[model samples]
Target: MRYYLNTQTDPAFNLAAEEYLLKSTNEDCCMLWRNHNTIVVGRNQNTLSQINPEFVQKHDIKVVRRITGGGAVYHDLGNINFTFIKVGEQTKKIDFSAYTRPILEYLNQVSVPARLDGRNDLTVDGLKISGNAQHIHKDRVLHHGTLLFDVNLEMLATVLLVNPEKYRDKAVQSIRSRVTNIRKYLLDHPTVEQFMEDLGRYMQKAYQAVLTRFSDDDLKQINDLAQKRYRQWDWNFGDSPAYDFSRSIRTPGGTIDIRMKVKEGTIQRIRIFGDFFGIDPVSDMEKRLTGCRHDHQSIKKILNAVDIERYIKDVTVDQLLHCMF
Candidate 1:
């Protein structure tokens, strides 16, 4: 098997490279990568429902969907991602222990007592430190997972906060686990770079893995894929399923009730109802927001450019944005 250590931190480019290597490359491979302040959601997840919109926008975190069906994961420079693409029949590929063996072995070598608990989680003393997921193809499999070494636990907890009571849908929900950083358990905690280096050496010895570098042509292909798919709003967020959302907020102007049906991450219908007054009904303003993305900045820009005062009297742009997001 070949091994790669990706130095790029752009979430879209890294994710696109994963897919490129998975479907295009013929060799069995193992790769280690990292992303900066990113939320890689599952392919089938409702992106809006899985994230704390305010926190995400406040921190400028990127939300990118992955090609696997698992819960969302928060990644930063402190997190290490590992992927294994193998050529094998997937009919009996449900088990994840074989894939997790190397990680567990490495942990044991470092004197960290870790075990594979439940289906695919790697836990240290019963608290999860890794979450694994796999996707199967005709004769190949893509198994990937996250290793939380020194991730910001505060962001991990705060960023994924969603009021589950607000939306009732058939979308798969994420199961929150009690997570801990691997650095917390190590006596001499290694830096992320050092950890990756040690793991790479171990894998090289175990699998006789050869280190391969991407050529200019390979990166161009990956970047093109990134721009076309991973970096696009249509693929990352617009691909989410339809859902109803309503937020009632008390602003200085008035109590605003914002409700909308979002499909493919665009507002399908929107209604702004409040005890406010305007010369004209808020119909025009609502119509304007129909095709806007459900994100805070996207909708806020639209509201900022329009004469919101003309549509809804006394409702400031900030107030409308608060209710919309």
Candidate 2:
């Protein structure tokens, strides 16, 4: 097995690296890496429904969709991420224990008293410390997980907090659990960096793994993948499953309720209902919104082009946007 400690903190590049390693390489590999403040949503999840969009935009938190199917997870510098890519039988069933055994063993060696809580989580003292997910590509299985070392638990909660009633979809919903940092349970009180290094060393020794680095060609390819797919809005948001969004906001003009059906990130239909008086029918405005990307900028452009007050009295474009989004 080959082990690598990825030093890059860019979430896009790191996620791209996982795909590159899983599909582009033949050797069995393990990687330990980190990312700056970011939210990684599962491939089968609705990205908009999994996050608090206002909080995400206000903090400039990056949102990316991973290839694996699981719940959304928050990542920061204090978190440690691990990935294992192994070639296996194409017909083999998913096995969580096989990939998580080493991690559980390492935690036990550190006196953390960690144990697998369910099919895909590691917990200590009844509080979660890790969440894992997997992806199968032909004969290769890619398993990755997140370890909360000294993460900001408050930030993690806030970013993932979304109104359940806003979106109706068949996408998988993230199960919220009480999570605690691993550092608090450690007797040595080691820094996050130290903990990551120790875990990397343990994995290397356990697998008889040889340390490796990404060559210039490998890095260029990873970066190219990141730019072309990982960093694009289409992959991050447009790939979300079809969902129905409904929201109502009270403005100075009156109350406006927006119900929209979106597929592939494009609005298929929209209905406007409000008590506010208007000179023009709201259906005219709704028609303009159909086929537009369900994004702030795209909606804003359409709102700006028309005299919005004619349809909704005394309401500004920003106010209408607040209701639609």
Model 2 over residues 51-136: C-alpha lDDT tens digits?
A: 98878988999999999999999999999999999976474577888899999999998888999988899999999999999998
The alpha-carbon deviation from the true structure for residue 46 of candidate 2, after best TM-score superposition, in angstroms, is 0.8
Worst 10 residues of 2 by lDDT: 87-96
- The whole-model lDDT of each prediction reads 0.87, 0.93
The alpha-carbon root-mean-square deviation between model 2 and the true structure, to one decimal in Å, is 1.1
In model 2, the Cα lDDT at residue 210 comes to 92
Judged by whole-model lDDT over C-alpha atoms, candidate 1 comes out at 0.87
Off by over 4 Å in 2: none
Please report the candidate that would top TM-score against the real structure.
2
Clashes of each: 0, 0
The alpha-carbon RMSD values of the candidates against the true structure, listed in the order shown, are 1.7, 1.1
- Which digits, one per residue and each the tens of the lDDT, describe model 1 over residues 1-325? 8998789999999989888888887889999999999998999888888998878988999999988888988999999999988875557556689899999999998988999999989999999999999888777888899999999999999999988865555677888999999987788888989998888889878899999988899899999999999988888889987888888888666778888988888898999888777786788888888999987778888888888777777778877886765
